[model samples]
Target: MKLQKLTGVWIPLVSIFFGLLAGAIIMLLFGYNPVAGYIALWNGAFEEPYYTGETIRLITPYILSGLAVAFAFRTGLLNIGVEGQVLVGWLASVWIGLAFNLPMIIHLPLAIIAAIIAGGLWGFIPGYLKAKFHVHEVIITIMMNYVALYSVNAIIRNVLTDGSERTEHVAETASLKVEWLTQLMPNSNVHAGIILAVGAALFYWYFIEKTKYGFELKAVGYNSYASEYAGMSVKRNIMVSMAISGGFAGLAGAMEGIGNFGYMTLNNGFTNIGFDGIAIALLGGNTAVGVVMAAGLFGVLKNGALNMPLSAGVPHELVDIITALIIFFVAASYMIILFREKLTNIFNNVKTKLQKGRGK
Candidate 1:
């Protein structure tokens, strides 16, 4: 029993260690100094104030997006629509930020609220369809992603800015400038979005841990038929879950738009933030603390990947290999769990046989 419990906790640690070992092996195979490459990557991620801020910046979006995916996972809904929700959220935030002439406090919150609403509505479409017509959410979400992409581009080009493929730069009043972010790294676009992400994480934890609604969602997730028989509205829960999940995804997009870029431009196409969130959620096991930590890990990797090629002569592609290996290890953790169990059983058997022989 103790061995089983220990295995539960140590499995994740072992997976991470093995993943790093695999990454090092790959680096050595490629004729690179693995230690130096890893050092360079770590230093690039943390050496300077600017790089630290960049890590936070990357983490901010990951936190929100990861929460989005995790939330749906908890509710038994696979929210593949987060990509579309993010795009719509970006469009809504920039459109409102550029068009409105409100004060900073009002404008910023309004833009965020609008983005959340837009994302929620986008999510609600799939939820309602699933509940009412039994349409597969995966197919709907995939189609909606492309729809949102094209729709946003069209709005930016035709209606919003006269075929410019971008919105006017948001007014200065609407930027998410915070003193700490600015003081920590001058000229960096990092801002209060980090606070927003943290707040969202806390809120999600509280919502799931301390609310009747949360219980309903979980019950529905485990078994909709049972939940319905037990007096919970499964349909309502589904709609609510999707809305809340998409709202988080929307906030991720809004952070990138208002806090980082201060405008919506079609230069980068869709960022795949929603899809990345799926990976984050999977790696984190759909838990609150796990999601936050996974997001931070991803942030560090991304920040360091940028500097690896230039500094260590280790191609940036190595980072991709590292990340892929990490994900593979995570996905295959059952093997580690099995190995641990077998070892524990063998040890116990040996201990028992020795004790019996001594008594005889």
Candidate 2:
């Protein structure tokens, strides 16, 4: 049990270490002061209450996006349409936020539910087509990303506003920005979304690790045909998995619309949160606890990178390079496993020789 726990952490830790080392080497080659750069990063992420709060805010959506991807993976699907799901979810949430005049207690939950349902329905399209028509989800999901991008822009221009570039700000009743949290982390855009994020993580842990449905999902993931043979509803499970994955992704969109931005605007491009979730989920080994930690790591790296040029005369883009290296290392973890085994064997051989010498 101990070894299994250690193994779960080892791959990501080694990947992060080598990635940072390689980043330092690159900085050296480019005549940049790596130590100063690192110091600046550390300060940016944790130097004051504001930066700390910002990092936490950044982590909020990442956790949801990672959970979205990880949950789908657990159920034999790759939900690449999370970007679309987030777009629809954001629009839906903000629409509810603007269109409603209810009390805070009612308005907030209604907006959240709207977002979840919108995103869930968006995901259902691809899952249904895949399950019923035997179409590949990846192709449909990728195409839907462009559809989402254009559709959001059109909706903003034609429907949401009076042909304006952005929607009106959400009502305070529907907003996630609470007075207490703002006072707690003054001058930061952090909001109550962190609470939602943490709660969602707990939900993910319980659902994916503690429930019978989770086992059936994993079983379907391993082999759909076999799961069906064992009397599981493969098609129903697939659709349910995608919908749930998208529901999580939709909540991530709410973190942006109602929490951070408080409105929806014309999106000229993808939010990239869904794509980043893929990397986050991969690094996290598809585990709930691992996803939370990985989200924190990414949050720090991204938030801290903003300070690099100002503090150390280093380009912030180096963070992207380091992130890519870390992911590459993760992808090559088999080599790390082999290296560890070789070292273990060598250590055993040396211990055996020393024991023989002592006996002789």
Candidate 3:
């Protein structure tokens, strides 16, 4: 068991090392100083209080989205619709913010709940279809993403605003911003959403590791037919798991609406927040602790990438390439394990032959 856990940790760490090495080679090829570029990347994410705050702010939504994807993965479902769920959640949370005029205690939670519900409902549609008719969730959820993209844009233009590209800022009562926190790192977007992210992470750990429902979900994931044969309600678990996953994603939108941006805007394309969650979840090994760590790494890479060009004369796209390479390594981790085992056997065989010859 100890070795198994170590293997999991080593796999991702090795993947990261190889990815950085590849990035360095690429930078060398392009006549850029790799060390300088990495230093700039590190500085961009942590050297200044403002950058640190922004990186934390960026990581907030990533944790939730990572949890969203990881939760679905645990339950043997593919929730590609998290992007759509985010749009609806953002729309709902922002709408509540725009429409409400209540006390902070009531207004804030209300908007959050609205977002959770909206995103949950969006996810429920595909979950229900899969549960009832055995549909492919990937296809349905992919289509839902486009529908969410267009519909949210339309709603923002037609209903939320009078044909405007963005809605007015949300009320301060509903906002996640706190003056003292902002004062801690002046001009930073960081807010109380980090608190929520931490709490959600704890909740995720407890639920997935401690609860009976989580066990059922895991069992279903291993073999849905077997779970059904053993008298588990496979259909019910599927729906509930997907809904829960969607709720996490919807909360991610709440971070955007009330925490970072404090408003909604029309997008010409997908923000890729949900898509990125897939990679985060993958890198995280679908664990709560893993998700948080993965999200932090992503935050650093993304926030730092923007500074590469200005600080080290390296294009930000290099970071993108590095990220892709890292993901590739992760996906190919099975082959890595196999290769390592093969090398180990070869070494053992050589050592045995050497010992026999010495004895003779």
Candidate 4:
């Protein structure tokens, strides 16, 4: 157990080390000082209270988004439609927020529920198709992303436009902004969404690790045919898993619509949060705790990248390169394992030789 824990910790650390090493090599080849660039990156992300709060704020949605992908992965599904779900959720949340006026106690939950339902419905389509007809989910999801993009744009232009390319701001009751938090973290957009995200993570961990339904989902993931043969309802599990995943993604959108931006605007392209979630999920090993930590790391890199070019004369794109390298190292983890095993064997052989000489 100790060995397993150690390996788990070291693997991610090693991947990060190699990723940074590769980035440094690239920077050297391009006539940049990696040391200065990294220092600037660190300072940009952590130098001020405002930057810290911003990083935390960014981490909020990333946590939920990463959970969405991680949940789907644990259920043996790849939910590429998270982007679409987020879009639909954002629209639904903003629409409801603008359409109603109630006390914060009621309005906030209502808007959140709207977002969740919208995202679930969007996820349901692909889930239903995949379960009922064995259709490929990846293709359906990719196509649905475009559908969501155009659909939301049309709605904004034709229905919600009021001389702008966005919907009206939501009422204070529906907003997730905490005035005290904003005041406390000056120049930061801190909101109550971080609390929600933490709650979601706890819920995810509990449900997946402690619930019977979660066991069923994992069973199906491990072997759907075997699970079905054992009388588990594979189709139902698939739909449920997808809906839950979509709900998480929807909550992520809610953070943006009601917490960060307080409105829905025309999206010319994918927001990239869902794509980033993919990397976050992979880095976290599709686990809840892992996801949260990975999200924080990503949030730092993203927020820090903004100041790298200005502060260190380094291209911000280097962060992207580092991120890609990290993912590549993770994907090619077998190489790391092989290298470790070779080192272990060599050490053992040398130890044996030394002991034999001593005996002689």
Local error of candidate 1 at residue 123 (angstroms): 0.9
Q: Kindly list the per-residue Cα lDDT of model 3 for residues 1-360, writing each as its tens digit.
A: 898788778777888889999999999998999999999999999989899999999999999999999999988998988888888888899999999899999999999999999989888889999999999999999999999999999999999999999999999999999998899878999999889988988999999889998899999988999999999999999889889899999999999998999999999998788999999998888889888988999999999988889999999999999999988898899577888999999999999999999999
TM-scores for all candidates: the values are: 0.90, 0.92, 0.93, 0.91
Model 2 lDDT-worst window of ten: 330-339
Better of 1 and 2 by TM-score: 2
TM-score of 4: 0.91
Which scores higher on lDDT, 1 or 2? 2
Off by over 4 Å in 2: 1-5, 335-360
Best by TM-score: 3
Q: Count clashing residue pairs per candidate.
A: 0, 0, 0, 0
Better of 2 and 3 by TM-score: 3
Score each candidate by Cα lDDT: 0.85, 0.90, 0.92, 0.90
Q: Per-residue lDDT of 146-229 in model 2, one digit per residue for the tens? A: 888899889888888889999999999999999988887899999999899889989998988889898888898999999999
lDDT of 4 at 352: 100
Q: After superposition, how far is residue 317 of candidate 4 from its true place, in Å?
A: 0.8
Global local distance difference test of model 1: 0.85
